[model samples]
Target chain A: MSAPDLADLIENLRRFADDRDWGRFHTPKNLAMALTGEVGELVAELQWLTPRESAAVMDDPEAGARVRAEIGDVMIYLTRLADVLGVDLIQAAQEKLADAALRYPAP
Target chain B: MSAPDLADLIENLRRFADDRDWGRFHTPKNLAMALTGEVGELVAELQWLTPRESAAVMDDPEAGARVRAEIGDVMIYLTRLADVLGVDLIQAAQEKLADAALRYPAP
Candidate 1:
């Protein structure tokens, strides 16, 4: 599949959520907390695996599918919450970097 | 000061970079590479600190200042990079969360 811009992907997902009538559940507080919970679940997938083993699971087809699903869930909530708050995730990230450069310009 | 929206924050930073004529240096490749470098530097700060020590440093005035500076740097560059590509950082993050929720769905 072609790599659609993330913005478009997000728009599509938002529509999906809205269709499911799930948008009502996506309050910023709930979405943010859910993001953390999903991260916890992702970490749980490799709780006791050796670093190498954990990495291995990332490549396993079934496990990879699950992981990818988890990742998609996280992204969906993040996009919904961010849209509600009117912040641009990528731009915010770059601003952080720019601030870093100014704070610690090449020494 | 009241927090301006992150979109505004990013726009302002972009202007700052443009003022410095540094936008030329922010090709996605360079920005992404620099982001990794800055993250490495931030990690280097507490490379060997005990978890407790690391936590302490987070609250220490001087170290906190430097850490915040590093974080700001990270945001600035991230914003700059995201803006160039026209992606919204917050929205992207939320999308990730939404995707995660669908993946895990309170299971």
Candidate 2:
């Protein structure tokens, strides 16, 4: 199957919100906050685990599914925030890497 | 300026790793763990805010900058995780919405 596009995902999210009359509640600030909240849930899954143990989280099927769902939650909110703010997630990521390159140049 | 592309961002990250001989440390498991850690940092910024207060987070310039930086961190690690696993983030996001649609049909 073909992969999804960023625009399409944003559109779907927008429509989802519009359908639920959640547009007003989805301003960038609120969306960003919600994004962080979802991220917290994702983080909770790995809390207190040693790096090795954290790395093995997906070894358990149920835990793996939870992680994936949390990832999806984080992604959905993030995409919505970016959309509200008119930030292109991929583009912002590329620019951040460019900035990082300047900070940590090849040795 | 033109927007950045996912493939380009992935390439830049890959090059950054290769330059540091850090490829071995960037396995999918490690990246996923790092992603959650960064997400935790992002969540900390809005930890105690009520919805209204949370929505005003960006109203404080310093806090706004911190929030943005944390967002950048989360994005970078997430992108890296997807790259390591050969998952197309945009596509995966799209498919996720499709699955969500089936679960939460429009009313």
Candidate 3:
């Protein structure tokens, strides 16, 4: 199955917020805070593992599931924050990637 | 112009790593740590301001640029992490969102 695109995800999240009457609470500041919290959850999943082990985390079903869920959470909040700010998430990413390429040229 | 999609972003990031021969360092753990650092930068942009100020951050051209770039960095690293872990970013997000919807039903 084709996964949801960024626009679809944004629309889905909008509907989710609307359903709960949460649009008022979804300010950029709050969404950023929530994004931070999700990032923490994502990090917690990898915090204690050795480099090799962490690299292979998905080999273990349980830990892998947790990591996936956390990544999902991170993406969701980040998308919402960008949406609220009227930033095109993919465009922003492309611009930053271009800038990084110049700063750190291939040698 | 259409912005780059997730696959394009992932491919671009892979090329960035390949060009610098940095693929070896891009373990899931390293990516996660890098993701956390980027998230920290994103948070710093919004951290000290009052809620109202933070909500209106994008109104200031300078702060808005910073926030946009930080969001880009976070997305880039998160995308990389998901790629390295063999997780489909959108699919993972869809799953987590579904779970959240079930847990947080409309009242």
Winning model by DockQ: 3
Ranking by TM-score: 3, 2, 1
Cα error of candidate 2 at position B62, Å: 2.8
Instruction: List pairs with backbone clashes in candidate 3.
Output: none
lDDT of 1 at A42: 46
Candidate 1 shows a clash count of 62
Residue-wise C-alpha lDDT for candidate 3, range B1-107, written one tens digit per residue: 35568789889999999999999999988998898899889889988988789888999999999999999998899889999899988788878889999999988
Tally clashing residue pairs in candidate 3: 0
- Each prediction's Cα lDDT score? 0.55, 0.72, 0.90
lDDT of 2 by residue, B19-105 (tens): 988877876557766776776776788777776675667778887676667677778888776666455667656666778788877
Query: Highest lDDT, which number?
Result: 3
For candidate 1 chain B, which ten residues in a row score worst on lDDT? Answer: B66-75
Q: How close to the true structure is residue B63 of candidate 3, measured as C-alpha lDDT?
A: 99
Rank candidates, lDDT, best first.
3, 2, 1
1 or 2, greater by lDDT: 2
Tens-digit lDDT string for candidate 2 (A1-107): 25565667788899988887888898655776677677667668777666666566667788767766667777888888766655567766666677888998889
Q: lDDT tens string, model 3, A36-77? A: 899888888888999899998999999999999999999999
